[model samples]
Target chain A: MSLAKRIIPCLDCDNGRVVKGVKFVDIRDAGDPVEISKRYCEQGADEITFLDITASTEDRGTTIHTVEAIASEVFIPLTVGGGIRTLQDIRDMLNAGADKVGINTSAVLNPEFVREAAERFGAQCIVVAIDAKCVSGPGEPKRWEIFTHGGRKPTGLDAIAWAQKMTAYGAGEILLTSMDRDGTKNGFDLDLTRAISDAVAVPVIASGGVGNLQHLVDGIKIGKADAVLAASIFHFGEYTIPQAKAFMREQGIEVR
Target chain B: MTHLAVIDYGMGNLHSVAKALEHVARRADLTFKISVSADPKVLQAADRLVFPGVGAMRDCMGEIRRLGIDEILREQIQHKPVLAICVGMQALMERSEENGGVECIGLFRGEVRRFAAGQHDAKGELLKVPHMGWSEVKQRAHPLWRGIPEGSRFYFVHSYYVQPHDSAEVVGVTDYPAPFCAALARDNIFAVQFHPEKSQDSGLQLLQNFLTWSGHA
Candidate 1:
């Protein structure tokens, strides 16, 4: 069977509000995360990911409620992340109708947490989110370093090496985000994405710096990512998921 | 009332499948009760059953054996409609090569084998393991495909695929690098390697079809 590269719409929910997300939609009231998600599913998004920037207890409840509401209507898979520290958090998200849960800082803190959760919940649902930025000297070789605490804390771990380790630890997928390209609207860091994808046997999702439809295609074409995750591009009605899929199909890339 | 019980051995996306069935119940205008249950009595009482599984086949079978899901499956398969997915489908085979050849429920006459690592497609591009993402499934005269179109994309994430001893039991085949069983059906049992719950509209349709189907095909 011809497996089409996936297109995922990421929702960045900050304190129950859509802050710095979706350039075209009004951020007030978080624009109803449930409603926004349903529209994307109708437009043929393969999956939806929700990131709670603050990840407070109150926001966690809100995220769970939002996931329930969206899960009731949306037929596709849903992934939720941000401040998911323990196994209980993953269980709560999955119980709240999330198909997958993304983990970042917690995994960096306790690398074994990846193996623990994957073993308990199955690696199929454990997504290790890597937020990375290129670090290099003028004459030295360049490499992407893993950043945690929402890209604030530099862990000094090589992104590519960490990806390989996470895979060995039983991570089903890697959500790799480029801190340098995020919100820049330039394009994805194809080199970084390709490196991690090449290093791991599991699927890698390319995030950050998606300006147009072509960037999405390039993620799969040049970066060799299994999926492309975007926020404002689809949030503000910049481009519907169907339009993006059509463009990718036109480029001889399979999209569903 | 139609009740669809999703067998829970503590793995896979049971809620997603339940939610999709709930949506299909409303959309199809059919009254239904969907439940995710580990209790044998609750599962045995349902009008239909959905066996959803994920993770490594070894652990999946471990929980299945621990919870006596195999016994329940055998008893229920004779009387009610049962739908299996992913590792749930894999576990129906006689054995699996994953985790050094784990024996399964022997419900279907087949063996599950791992896809060759470092395999490449016709284009010479490297084919990754786990086969994650959406793939088009070619239908083959199955009642579970009643309202769905042929060649519809279904989400797949697995390292091993089933190689049934009897090829006639295969209903849907998808070509990742080579043709393999994507779905199979016999008697009242219907199983698929793809995740219909995550496959969007077409997937919902498949669930709806399962909800309404009797144990005929």
Candidate 2:
């Protein structure tokens, strides 16, 4: 049987350490990635996702060293993203003890890269990430488009359509994030989530805009996402995974 | 003499559970020497045991036997109080689906099965499986519920449930699929589906009660 809905704690790895911020701005030193990951694992996080935001641009290796150190101690699935362009990048990530590899820009630029990665490392090992932002202004409010290079540039590619294509190309899962809601603490964009979830067969992890217990519950129950991803709410001790799952259970969502 | 041994069965969040218990002990104004060990000598010297586990029931039981501490654990449980959380509580059952159809610790006379939507619990569409979160525990005078408020919420995360052979052993119950048992006590064996160490102040009180309990059964 498939796992129950999971509450995942996401760690943003800058250089070699874990960092946090509001709206991904004013970065503050959170702690070592390994230490933070261990804490989350102990607190009962179903899984951990580490996003190396600077790796792709810096031409540095995937934070496999960080993954190895953390995975050696933590006995849970570790999903890694950032700077994952080629099949070699995916191999390095998985070899470093990462259970899955997330690709964003390269997958968008070369759609075939997604297919190739899936061929090399089983579709289940490949996760296509879509960082989308709502663009409304010209004629009928343009659909949410994809962003790359750490949410800095807009690709003008429709997110929903691209998600279907990515899954078609061989991604096992889609880590869809709403840039507009990335650090807002408001809640998730249900419309975008539903659209993509409906378009793809793979599990959709609804990321961004988790402010409180209700937000987590609403994201899963209302948004119909397979899992909910959050950071500040967990890292700051605002709520623990068990607490969040309890609230979700109350709302009748099947969470682990 | 108050050394609390948290069993590292190789399939659980042992360190975090130890830290939480340590915090609860500090809060209770009791000094509890907590450590994670698989040594039988360490298990024997402990005043109490907290059997904490995560993942599948079969894998957990395999770890217990793999570490060669299953017999020692059964022997120790007869003399001292042992608290099992989440999957650790599930391991006390007779069998589980996750174990590739293998038997569990058989500590309790029941099988651990998934929380099927309509079959297990009474409610048609009320409780969901993998019951996660902080929920209220309704108790009727169990030692494990000592000092814990009525309807006080505790943390829980698991899909399988322990159906005790004797109904009286279920001291606390929660409304998930029509009021299932949340806490069980039989002789010196005490197990809860919820994580008391992570349940904040109210949960810490429950841990304190376990520490001081005389294991009178």
Candidate 2 lDDT tens digits, B51-149: 976555555677778886668778998788888887778778777766357677878887666566433333232233345455678887867677777
The lDDT, on a scale of 0 to 1, for candidate 1 is 0.85
Best by DockQ: 1
Question: DockQ score of candidate 1?
Answer: 0.64
| lDDT leader | 1
* lDDT for each residue of candidate 2 in A33-58, tens digit (9 for 90 to 100): 88888888777786789998777667
Q: What is the lDDT of residue B47 in candidate 1?
A: 95
List ranges where model 1 is wrong by over 4 Å. A21-30, A56-62
Q: Residue-wise lDDT of candidate 1 within A47-89, one digit each (tens)?
A: 9888886663233433687777778888788888887878888
lDDT of residue A8 for candidate 2: 81
Give the chain A TM-score for each candidate: 0.93, 0.95
Each model's iRMS = 1.8, 10.1
Candidate 1, clashing residue pairs?
Answer: A1-B174, A1-B175, A1-B176
